[model samples]
Target: MYKKILVAFDGSPYSQKALTAGIELARCCGSELHVLTVVSLPEYAGTVGEVEEMVGKAQDFYRKKLEKASQQAKTRGVELKIHLLFGHIGETIIRFAQEQECDLIIAGTRGWSPLQRLLMGSVSTYIVRHAPCAVLIEKGKEEDGNG
Candidate 1:
């Protein structure tokens, strides 16, 4: 059973699905939930201030998304905390997970076809490959009530 769950989140629907899954997992295990959003600065091609500004904007967006998720956790009475980080997404996630002593890291898979992934790579892939702890790569979408 997981004692501390670290979740990597963004504003994407995929990330939201992972967040919901993380919430349920934490609830079931009575684990402390640590939600993290990483703002990856574009490498070069911009002024320092511009890069900083973009990172700040991304952090703001992450904060808002984390707040939304917090409301859900609060309603369910689940223990949850939020963090916004500025760095390479994969590296930051692994580093934070280790620093926090998180037992598991949950993250969503981004869209990347097999060929494209071989060329450009993917974040979830990197995390799965490099993270020292357990990682769950969630990609499924929410079920429609139509069923």
Candidate 2:
């Protein structure tokens, strides 16, 4: 059974799936649930003020999403702890999982093609390869409600 479960969420449909799965798993195992959303700053911001502005904007945007997710978990009788950090997606997720001592990491995938992943570098893939704990990846179901 998992003691702590971390869901890497970004408010996308794919991440929504991950959140749902994480909630279910936490409920089943009586685990602590955490949702982490990371904001990756632009490589070269013109000024430090710009970087702070970007983080502020991202916080404003993700706060609502995380709140909604918290409500969702509440309906399932699970308490959700949320974290927002600034860093590369995969690296940040891994580091947070380690720091939080998560027993499981759940993430959703966009189902990128091999070629697309090669070029774009999939975050879920990177996490799967490098995460400190066990990882679960959720993929979207087909239109027929099958996966």
Candidate 3:
């Protein structure tokens, strides 16, 4: 049984599936549920003000997503705590999981092809390699004709 569970979300359909899975698992285990969305800071900014503006906009965007996620969990009778942070996505998620002492971390995959993942570098792969605890990656459904 998990005492604390964290779901790494990004407002995507894949992440929504992860949220649903987290909610159901939390309900079953009577665990504290947490949803985290990380906003990747720009690699280069013209000024500090520009960075601040980007962060602000990201916060606003993720806030609405988190709210919807909260509502979804509420309907499932699970209370989900939401968090938003700015950093490299994979590192931020792992750090937050460690800080929260989460027993389990759930994340969603984009179902990218091996070539795509190799070229793009996968966030889920990094988390799986570096996370402090157990990880469950929810695989996204492939679109028809892709195969």
Tell me which residue pairs clash in candidate 2. Answer: none
Q: List model 2 lDDT by residue over 1-147, tens digit each.
A: 999999999988888889999999999999999999998998878899989999999999999999999999999999999999998999999999999899899988888788998999988999999999999999763331121
| Per-residue C-alpha lDDT of model 1 across residues 37-97, encoded as one tens digit per residue | 8887888736889887897788667677789889888877797898888888889999999
TM-score of each: 0.88, 0.93, 0.93
Candidate 1's TM-score: 0.88
Q: Residue 82 of model 1: what lDDT?
A: 89
Name the lDDT value of residue 125 in candidate 2.
95
lDDT of the candidates, in the order given: 0.83, 0.91, 0.90
